[model samples]
Target: MKRKLLFGERMLLGDGTEPFNAVIPFRLHGIFKEEEIRYALGRLQEKHPWLKALIQYDEQHIPWFQVPEATVSIPIRLVNRENEDDWQEESKQEWHSTFDYQTKPLIRFVWIKGEVVSDMLFVFHHCLCDGGSAMALLYEFLKVLDNPNAEIGLENPILGIEDVVPAHILQSGKKQFKAKTIGRLAALAIKCIPVGRKVIDRQTDYLIHWKFDKKTSEQLISYCKSRGITVNTFLGATVLEAFRKVRGAAAFNKVSCPVDIRRFAPQIKDDHIFAFGLMIVMSLNQKLNFMDNLRLMQTEVERKTAKLNPYITMMVMESAHDALKNFTRLLKRGKSSNDCMFSNLGRIQIPDQYRTFSLETVFSPSVIGPLGNTTTMVTSTFRGQMDFSFMGSEGYLPQAEALAIRDEIIGRIRQQLDYKTAS
Candidate 1:
């Protein structure tokens, strides 16, 4: 079975030189037998058809998820762990590693073997799935890894926009005319605009990861609840503040927040392997007080998120597919208008205790695309602790500045909680 790549997915595929990969690294507190690991992956591939497929380009040079008659298991690479941070180093390497999508599956694994603790990195081409889909796969992988006989049901993926947008909407001549007009206007504008010159020279990318203690994590959650704001909104406000403070007032206050499309489109199942993303740009009003700014930001987040129309956005993107190459060029050359991309995976629902192995910690997933501006901060709470993984290139955000921003964000959150406790 094969399906043409979605407009969003094709954008990630780029010129095929740079890989857009997402890696989820988690620590396990038990030894994993090599054969058993392979068996578990084989079972997972059997369940999800996309996991066993490779990317193939048709004569028209369009990419497709092509499933061959011969079964191909997701490959696993083993690295002898020297210390606790071996996985971190391996993750950096994986970020730079390009996938041979023609011959191998879009997903692969890396196992860092330690004496008592092992860290496994689940790496996938970002075009194949988003962080949400990756998390679902991780959950099932653990379940099957712990028990080979475990039954993790099959997934019915959204093959195309037809599956997501209702037939009535697609058939409406008014909607079709609107989409066509918008697409044509966009293409004309793109053609008329000059390609931006690449000014920033990106250096070797780095990832900084840390986890807040359970107490601090709980306090942060309580603080957000007390403010009547979602954790994501609160964190988004803090991130904006941190950049403004550390990178100076001139830094862009815009923070791109990705909303899972599954929330708006029920047809895309939770376990489906898909990569269409909906993003909302959140900005803070510098005139307001810190707390006041947070409240305003929270309100804006709620309002904008509620208004997001996944169907229209998907349709618009599909219409602009003809100008995708130009869009890619613009992205690669243009200066980043946003400070950073912030993603909060919320509290991870994966169990800590499995039958065979116990999950020690789940580091926030990180992905560095070849697109301009590699600064991204990803957060997720697992086992009652909030874990963060910050990725950036020196050219876009220096390592020292990134670390400072991380500390500033954490400090801002803690300071608010501390003040509340004292008052």
Candidate 2:
């Protein structure tokens, strides 16, 4: 059970020493034993083969995911719970913690142990999976933690590019030619693009987390619904507007949003440990009113999403393997172009209660890589409340400025809801 890492995976792996980690933190409101957690993690690894796999490099230095002859236990770190906010600090610690990729699996569990309430954090190397995959694993973990004998089925792992791109698309000579041409052009552009000789400092990373109560969350959702715009687009507009107002002329007026690849490629299941994503860059029209601007942005989002071709995109990326390093350099040193990357996971579907422990809540996931810009906003609704995790570094965005942007977002949403109430 071994396969070479895909292009996107290699980019994220980044020499295998630097950490590109994602953390999913959730609270459980019942007593849980360490053995129970170990049992549950074992079951999770059984369901997803990649969860137990380790990275190995061949003579040529290309990395591959290989299941060891003997099964490896998923690493678990236990911490005494001091307060409710301990998980956030622990998450920051995990962000900078690099995985021993060659020897161990690219995932770990941190248990903030308490008598009645325990906070569990699942941290993963971004190269192994995306946020959607993490959420699916979280659902399964809770299910199995309650009942170790839970009959969760096994995963049929995606081995190579052939598994994702259909036979017809892979064999199409014309499409192949098109993809190769685009790949060459892109590589050329990256080579020509002027980037700084050194990477940005991005000093002292930080995370800001907050949640709206059920009533306020519902009202915000209702406002977006009444305006006939998606919560994602509305949020994107809100983020861009906030950055513009706070940064003034310093704002880039652009936001990059990651569209889940599973949405377009049926071959990639919700539980597949895959990390490839398609992104669309959006900005607001400065001249239009807020509602009108949201409508336009929504239209643009629809258009871009409709035009996305995962098959071709994957094919093109695969053809550009030789340019991976250069592409990575551009990402690390290129002048910042976007205000931030914003992602809305929408509503979480996992049940909040089990037979034993009642799930307290799920925090919006946070990710920070060594990439040039670390500013990002992630929002998700869990249990009738919308949660947000805003991450940034002092060098890329001052903590004070980030706080101002956060307030602006909350204020803008409230102002819109208030206007609706008055009308």
Candidate 3:
């Protein structure tokens, strides 16, 4: 479809801040002919409204999908099948993929026809869909490829921004809710408790990604389970341990690990597909031994993971939005309080068969972050291996040192396992 950019797409163009997006891979075995593939793409476009449309207007990053309601209807690109040369040149332009900002959602495919191999990639705005939505997208495209006559029937489409109320409006009993939310954070920042000297870091930053074989990732998971510690905590503790070795013990003692708030609730929807997490920092006032720290960390991770609530996180995000929109003070303050951040998407299930083919080792993509000195870590377990990727600015933490830190932590985990066996 031919059209001007959608409002959400334009916001990204203006701000130059693409939300970190995900990439999906698919393998094809000879099924539908090449002519059939092209026909399927055209047919699929008519079936899925999202495939043919773009955002009408955007408030912040939220979008209101508009259907033009007029003489001319805007159309979106249906296929993003690019060759290897294109991805090579494109990768150079996205130098920030290593560290500057989050990845804009995109899919890169490796398709081979006869003796010729073709590499195709597609990028989408994160505001448009999450990982689950991407899964749905894959099927939509597949349906078109499988049968040009297939109909688009969405079990549940991506939620419109209207589905969620802006946080500013407190329901009848929400006034007190707002007060408590603000009160807790306010006390943390302004209270008599001395968190520590706040350092205004003014350093340029960068981030890069790494991958481990599927076997190693799986082994790590099994090892963690044997220890009765969550894989995330095991990996998280590894980071803290590495920092303690490099930045010194004092640094590691005070760091907080990120906790995803989804599993904490009894009936959380798999599609509540938004970000919600908290970091639980430890007190460094006292000394800690290596073994002691690990035991303590295991306990902390379990407790905090259980206590998180999505409702509260959603409420806080809305409150922050209201603060920025209404109060000049918060607008000037920039980002809400969040020091270092980490997230892990356990294991994404790959389809058993795709066009009569299967996935090889899934290539892990790196996440980009704000240039501010903030540190962020992301992990995904594919097959039996757990892959860890790090993002940080060169100004705050050198890439050379960051890689060394990762290695040392992995070594420590292994060392601990050895010590137990000898006994």
Candidate 4:
């Protein structure tokens, strides 16, 4: 079976040139056989049909997910475990490597083999899945790897716009007319607006990862709870403050946070391999204090989230398909107004102990898109420790500044927690 790509998916596919990939890297403790890992992936492929499908373009130049009769397995690349930082280096390389979507599966695995401890990187074309979907896949992979008899179960995914939006809505003449009118106006505006002609070279992309111990992580959670806010809201405020401190007050205070559409779209299960992104931009109020700024940001988050109509957004984007190239051009123009993209996956729910192997740590998933600004910070917690992976290119943000920003974010969070405790 085959289905046409959604507008979001097509944007991720780009012009089939640069690699737009998402990677989830984690460390495992115990002896794991290569054959067992391979077998686990095979089982996963059987459960998730998209893992075996390839992207094929039709004559109209639109992409489609085509499942072939022959079974296809996700390719795994094994590398000798050198040191703790090997995954980071490999992740940087993966960012530049383009996928041959027609020949191979959109997803691939890289195993850094070690005797006692090993690190594995699950890389996927951003068009195939989001971080949430990737995490679900990771959970199943570990489950089957520990016990080959384990049942991961199959997922019934909503394949197209027809599934997401009701037939009545799509077929409504009034709705269609409004959607087309808005789409054409937006497309015209996009064409009329002049963007930068020069492209900023993204040189030397780097990844910085660090984790806070159980004590600090717990304190952070307590602090957020006491403040009547979430960890995501607090982190958003902290990220904005860090940029202001490092990049000057004149720097943009905006941070784009991707909201998991599964919360709103029940048809898209957690196990479904889908790439549609729903995002809300949060900006700090420079006039207010840190705590005040955080509260305001949280309020805005609540309001924006409550008002987010996924169906309408999906419909509008699909209608604006003709203007996708202009949207891509705007992104590639290297004139982003946002400071960075901050994604907090919250506490990872995957089990730590398997019958055969134990999950030592789950590093935050990192992804760098070909879009101009590559400054992104991804956070997740596993086994009571909060882990972070900060990825950026020197062209967008200098390496030294990126390190300073990372330190500032951590320090700011700790400062808030410590101050609250002292009071």
Candidate 5:
């Protein structure tokens, strides 16, 4: 089974040299046998064809996911867990490790072995899946790991662009003309745009993680609800404020948020391995108070999200394949304008208890690639606690500064909650 790579997937695949990886780490508290893990992985591969497929390039250098006659099992690397923080170190290591897409599957599993507790890491190339798909896979993995006979449903994978966009839209000559015209114009703009001759030196990348206890998490959620703003918008405002406070004049005052394409396109299921995403850029009003700014930001987020046309965006992108080199060059050389990309996976609904092992907790996933700015903040709530993973490079944001920003975020959240309580 095989399918041509989508435009976004091709861009992420890059020369297959740099690693664009995402890591999902969770702690399981119980004894787990290697065979059981392998069994679960095998079931997953059988369910999702992409998990067993490798990448191959045609004469035109276009990439396609090709499945061999004998599918290879997903590789598992077991490491003895030396300390509680070992997963963080391993996650950083995985960020730089490139997948040999030509010979191996784009996904791998890392088992941090322990006496009775194990931290399992699911590391996959970003091109293979998004956070939504990862969560679905994780949910299924836990189910099958508990019971090898668990009947987790198989995925009806998206084959190509036609599967995502409606047939009517694709067949329309007027829309095709618009897509081609816009794509060409955008490609021309990219070529004409002037960028720095030298790319920003993202010296050393690092991940900073922290958690808010249940009480604080609930209070923040209540605060946002009372103010008629989403937790995402509230956190987005908080992070932007933290950057502005920490970096002072250096802050860009803009935060980019990636919206899941599944929300716009119902044809893409939760379990499908796909990575196309729409983005919305947000900024706070300097003149307004924090609460007022959140309301404004929420309004902006909704407006921007509503206006997102994933179908047309995908069409325009697919039409501009010839200009991908120039677009990539601009991303590599362009001066940074955004503060950071902030993503909130919201609450993970997977149960903590299983028949064999009890899930201790889930860490907010982290991802990094050869892209221009390596600054990203991801938040997710599990078991009533909100977890955060803030990743950045030393060249873009020093470790000390990242720590300060983390502290600033926590402090701001506490302050807001306290004020709301007082009132």
Candidate 6:
């Protein structure tokens, strides 16, 4: 049967960091048959267009890929020369880290290359797939290998959402209200806009990650239930609190949250889930104060959650080309991209069904930066625990400073969770 791609599929972000490459680490119990894995990817790529696309530039200074159906060998490079015991673990950073935008990553089959081969890491940029797409690919890959004739195909790529809906029209990517709604919201943005500030003093370097265990997770879950707030609402609160601690109130007026378009268009699948998702902006300043933060954030989050039947984000830029024009191109040359995007891809599924390996923790670090600052975060859940890893540039955010601020903020959440029993 003929397949297709959706609006999000064709839209990928590449001004700096490619937003679709996803990295996954898989453990092999037995020796990996190189040819079998190669064949598996070949068959998978034939069904997914993203793997075939390459990051290249045209004469116009604009970036676009000549997406074609091609199967490149998923090479596993083994470097035999190394002396690690002599230096600090920081010296071994290269093996564990990668520079943003460098999409083509080297896959290392640990067991084959050294004393251990069980932990194999596969890294890719988000230009290839979002969490949904990555999960789809994994499930399909495993299914295809298990059943060669399994019906595995993606919908043909089709454009659905505009890259950038004019802020003047939508005023934050939401379906702007009519004269009546506008009259109401205008009062709201005006009254609420004062406390909000544009983030200034961008830092350039940082290494920060936020992790939540099941106990904390359950506390948050219960807290949300008591307050009629979803975990997403709690996340919105956590994010605003984090930013307020660092960027201050400025994080409020300019926050962008992602809403999936698939709910609005079910016909689209993996290739189509690009940046076509919906966006809803909220006043982050309204989310200050622990109690008020929960109450206000819950309402705001609910407004967006009500639309999940539909999709924001640093991830927003993927489809931002929708608003791309000669005028915008000129204006954005020296401006920030979509303020600060807060993407909470809530709980994820890296199941333990495979006998070969058990699912451990899932770490998602968003590749976000523009206008000298990077403010993006992704959260994942594993074994009843959740961890959030944030990615940003050293140019706008010094790693140490970001972590310092992150720890202070994380401490607040811990305190809140600790008080849950008392409250």
- Candidate that scores best on lDDT: 2
Q: Report RMSD (Å) for each prediction in the order shown.
A: 1.2, 0.7, 7.3, 1.3, 0.8, 8.0
Cα lDDT of model 4 by residue, 1-423, tens digit: 788898889989997788999989999999988899999999988988888888898998888999888977788899999899999988887888889889888999999988999999999999999998999999999999999999889877657898877778788888888778877888898788788887778888999999999999999999989889999999988998899999995479899999999899887888888888789999988789988987888899999999887777788889998899998888888377888999999989999998878999999999998877999999999999999999999988999999999999888888888898899
Better of 1 and 5 by TM-score: 5
Candidate 5 per-residue lDDT over residues 28-127, each given as its tens digit: 9999899999999999999999999899999998999998889889999999999999999999999999999888999999999999999999999999
Candidate 6 local Cα displacement, residue 279, angstroms = 2.4
How does candidate 1 fare on TM-score?
A: 0.98
Candidate 6 lDDT (Cα, whole model)? 0.49
Score each candidate by Cα lDDT.
Answer: 0.89, 0.94, 0.46, 0.89, 0.93, 0.49
The CA-based lDDT of model 4 is what? Answer: 0.89
Query: Model 6, stretches more than 4 Å misplaced?
Result: 1-33, 54-70, 74-127, 142-206, 247-254, 270-273, 285-288, 304-339, 369-372
lDDT of 1 at 142: 91
TM-score, prediction 6 = 0.66
Worst 10 residues of 5 by lDDT: 327-336
- Please tell me which model should have the higher lDDT, number 4 or number 6: 4
Listed in order, each prediction's TM-score against the native is 0.98, 0.99, 0.65, 0.97, 0.99, 0.66
For model 6, the run of ten residues with the poorest summed lDDT: 84-93
